[model samples]
Target: MTQNIRVVVVGGGYAGVMAANRLTQRDDVAVTLINPRPDFVHRIRLHQLVGGTGDAVVGYRDILADRVALVVDTASRIDTTGRTVALANGAAVGYDYLIYAVGSGSADPSVPGAAEYAHTMASLEEAQRLRSVLDTTPTTAMVTVVGAGATGIEVAAELAAEGRAVTLVCGKVLHPYLHPRTRRRFAKRLAKLGVSIIDGPDARVTGVSRDAVRLADGRELPSTVTIWTAGFSVPDLAARSGLTTDAAGRLLTDETLTSIDDDRIVAAGDSAAPSNLPLRMSCQAANPLGAHAADTVLARITGGQPTTIAIGFFGQCVSLGHGAATVQLASKNDIAKAFAVGGFLGAKIKRDSFPGLIEHLAHEAHQPGSYTWKFRDDTRRQRLQTLAER
Candidate 1:
């Protein structure tokens, strides 16, 4: 009888859960998923949760494969040389293969007192906490959202629509990913919904206080609620494990999604920086990368060839205040085109995309032997060659 291959997946997010579900389908593999939380936090819905519009929690048992063992614990350390993972509870797990999907955290502003005074909408807990604060606050309470990225824009727009005094402070122009026309349309929509757009010369947030936010120009805006949605930084787990990482501490992986220094270790989601095609931290990359990582592992175990993970750029979607939105069509490089939609039509598309993504992930998880995509050594070699030439 063939020995059972032990595969351990850390983090129960989209990438980890999808990889665990895929790996468990193989009878020869025993999969163990480790996470600190029992339920998976749908991070994309965090903005909605903050706006008190939706529930951000989903039970993992409802989604994960029955064959996969769920271990509720934080992965404290990874001993790659010994093929063991130490948990926070003083238990160590041995694995023939390991998948690190430890995702990222909110990029806190470097400004003084912002860390203490500002609330971020990065996680479910933070969103819920922000909601609680909003519920008790007066309707005329001033709220300032720092950053104008997707998360910042969405939260600010949603809160503004609820009749709060909201101001969006963007270090740069709003909707930088959208075309100029689309950006102008969104700016008008936000203004119409009572959201003040502070950008360019008046954009930078210098400090946060209990009752106001200080700007770089020595101006202070009265704010009872302050939200920070600046950006994302990868978790320290990759660097802590002594794995090769990028400047931001994301694990550097080969084309096959395997760690460059250790073939037995693989990385996916926000924490992974692929050699040839590094992508931004989004569900678009995490879901596909998870599937690809599982396929790479199966190829190695099944004596099949590994396949190159392909990343294609999908268009951008942004929720305008209330029942309005903007969608921008983009090329493979994420360059925006003149094609754009706004108002109710764009909002429908934006709302529909969330469920559509979940359905696609569910469908991919149900496919049989989906883990065994052929690997291309030539692709890896060419990527290395390109890097050398650069």
Candidate 2:
């Protein structure tokens, strides 16, 4: 009898779950998925969680493959030489192949007192806590949302729509990923919703107090609550295990999604930096990366060559409160395009797709190789290659 291949996937985020589900296609492989939480966090809807409009989570049973063994535990370290992962619960899981899909979280900002006083919507717990804070806050309480990225914009809009006095402190520019015309429309919507937009060189947050926020330009904003959505930082498990990683601590992989240091180790999602050219950290990329990682493992097992990574880009969708959004069009390489869909149409896209994301995952679980996306653009591919060479 052939020995069964043991594939251990760490982190139960979108990428890890997709990889686990896809790996179940083969009978000869035993896939074990490790996650700290019992439920899957719909990170894209975390702003809704903060706004009290959504829960931002789905049970693993709803999306994960029934055949994939679930291990609820936290990974402390990866012993690559020993091919074992040490768990926080004092157990270790040995694997013939490892998939690193540990996703990202709220970055530790340099601003003083922000870590202690500010709220971040990086995880389900954080979102829940923010919700609780919002529950107690007066409708007219001054709430400052730092950063004008997707999370900040969404949270500010949602809260402002609920009658909270919301201020959006844009670090440098508002919706930098958006075209100027779409940005103008988005800004108008926010203003119409009673959200104050602070943009300029001095818009950067410098400090957070118990009830206030200070900007670089000596502007002190009276804030009863502060929400930080500035940047993201990944877990340090890869770096702690001494694996080769980028400056941000994401595991370095080749085009095939296998770790450069160890062929036995594969990487996907926000935790993976392939060829030093990682796609944007979004579900748009994570699902594909996860599917590709599983394909690579299966290819190796069947003595087949794995395909090189080729990911195309789609545009960004930003929810401006509940009934409005901005869908910025993009080229295959994710460059901003002039065309955009806004208002009710954009809101419909956001609302319709939020629930469909899980359904899409469930479909992948049932069909294994059912997930697919846009092919990579040649120009972008060549440009990335040039960057890698340099």
Candidate 3:
């Protein structure tokens, strides 16, 4: 009898879970997924969690494959040479092949007192903590949200719709990734909810205190609760484990998503820097990467050649509260296009997508090889070829 292949996946986000489920295609493969939290966090709905609009957690049993083992522990280090992962609780998990999908979290705020006072909503605990804080805060108190990315916009709109005195401090242009027309549409919706929009270079946060936040323009806003959604920072597991990593600390892999140092180690999701040209860090990109990573590992296990990754994006959907949303159309390469969708239709699509995403995961759990995605991006292909020529 042939020995079964043990593939250990780190991180239980979309990428890790999908990869684990897809690996169940072969009875000879055993998948073990290790996550810090026992439950899965619907990361796109984190803003809803913070604003009391929705819960952002799902039990792993609801979405994870029964054949896959779920380990709830933080990965402290990866012993690449020994093919083992060190856990925070002083345990070691050995594997025949390892998948690195350790996703990202809100970047630690360097603004004075921001880290100590301002709250983040990147994880379950953080969102719960922020929700608790907001619960105790008086409605009359000012809620200041820093950053104007998709997260910040959603957060600001969600709170403002709930009658909070919300001010969105855009470090620069509002919805920088959206086309100018879509940005205007979002601005109109936010205004309708009485959200105060403060954009421009001078709107950047310079400092944060218990009851106030200072701006770059020398104005201090009376902010009872400050929220930061500025940027993302990936866990340093790959770098600390002596693996080859890019400047941003993501594991460096070839086009096949295999590690440069070890063929048995594969990478995907936000923490994967394949060819040092990673896709945008979002669930949109992660799902396909997860499927592709499992394909790579399965190919190697079967003594077959793995194909290069070819991922693309549709666009971005930003929820503007329960009543409204905006879908920014984009090309496969993620450039915001001129046409956009807004209003009730947009909100409906956004509402259906979360449950739809969970159903996709559950479907894959029940039937391993059933889920497949459309993948063909001539733009991405041309860009990679150009990079190679240089």
Candidate 4:
């Protein structure tokens, strides 16, 4: 006799999937997930995809809840007033509540010739394109990886491990999120693997050509294939749809993850900027943000008020090929600590994190509330909540 509540979640990444799975806690709620790709992209292993060592996709059926309907289509626009989403396939999906989790993609580089010549590997399609290009080029081609973040380091190491002539064109210092001690350890490991790293005050990329990359120091490196992994850029769906957004284009939300314009609309994952203070854009934060987004919607539906959002931060893990990794230790506040772990243990933890991500979604799919209980860090949450208030 009760009316079914309809909830729509966009983007099937970690946050979207987790939110969809947890919404299954109520039989009266009908959940729908909209994603452009049929297969869920295991983002952490995207470097492996480019290196041809592993697949970066997993079937949605493997992790999504049975109760959630999967719609494979690109969302062109969101009609908040109508509570409907327009799809590229000329279809529309209606929702009583909407969760915006359309994660992020490689940033559009501004350096002259970089956009025209450089390649990026932020999505499955981009990775596959780079792989195809790699296949055609000579083995000795000078491969330049621009950027020193986790993606850049992983890509550079993966190629070097495969015996490719690889150069890491760090814009500045390497692994800026890591401590100086850990950065040194990573540099040594990379050097041992034969990766040419160019990093200094004037190491920023200035331009890119068909066969060379120019640096600010007036040096030009012969680069047959230039890959850009500098930063992430979110989709402008919210802005295109006339919704309020931060300077970075993320949907601006309050502590409850609800949009400033509409309580019926909430955001999570990389595209969510909460209280102008979003957690780092990573799968680690996405999983918990997803779960909490669902909780807010459920609370509103049942006449319970949604509380503040609090997510913990675990430092970064950069897999240096199959041989090693740098699991940077960090405080709950997400600062990298001096102590680090790697070699075999870091490799083990990084390997497990791949399936570990899927396991969280599967657990919530089979048993709705288990994710929040098993993975929630209460002490860290309290700390983050206090930070939000201030």
For candidate 4, the 10 contiguous residues with the lowest summed lDDT are 373-382
- Tens-place lDDT digits, model 3, residues 1-390: 343899999999998888999999998888999999889999998989888989899999999999999999999999988889999999999999999999999898999999998999887888899999999999889999998999999999999988999999999899799999989998988998999999987998999999999999999999999999898899999999999999888899998999999999999899999888888899888888988999999999999999998787778999997767888988888889998888678888888889988888899899987777774456766787899899
Candidate 4: lDDT over CA atoms? 0.91
TM-score of each: 0.92, 0.97, 0.97, 0.96
Clashing pairs in 4: none
The residue pairs that clash in candidate 1, if any, are 305-375, 306-374, 306-375, 306-376, 307-374, 307-375
Query: Which 10 residues in a row give candidate 1 its minimum summed lDDT?
Result: 371-380
lDDT of 1 by residue, 226-304 (tens): 9999988877887888989988888898878899999999888888888835676877667777888888888888888
Q: Model 1's lDDT to the true fold?
A: 0.81
In the order shown, the candidates' Cα RMSDs to the true structure are 3.1, 1.3, 1.2, 2.0
Query: Which residue runs of candidate 3 sit more than 4 Å off their true CA positions?
Result: 1-3, 388-390
Between candidates 1 and 3, name the one with more favorable lDDT: 3
Please identify model 1 stretches exceeding 4 Å from their true place. 1-3, 368-390
After superposition, the stretches of candidate 4 with alpha carbons farther than 4 Å from their true spots are: 1-3, 373-390
Candidate 4 at residue 200, lDDT?
A: 92
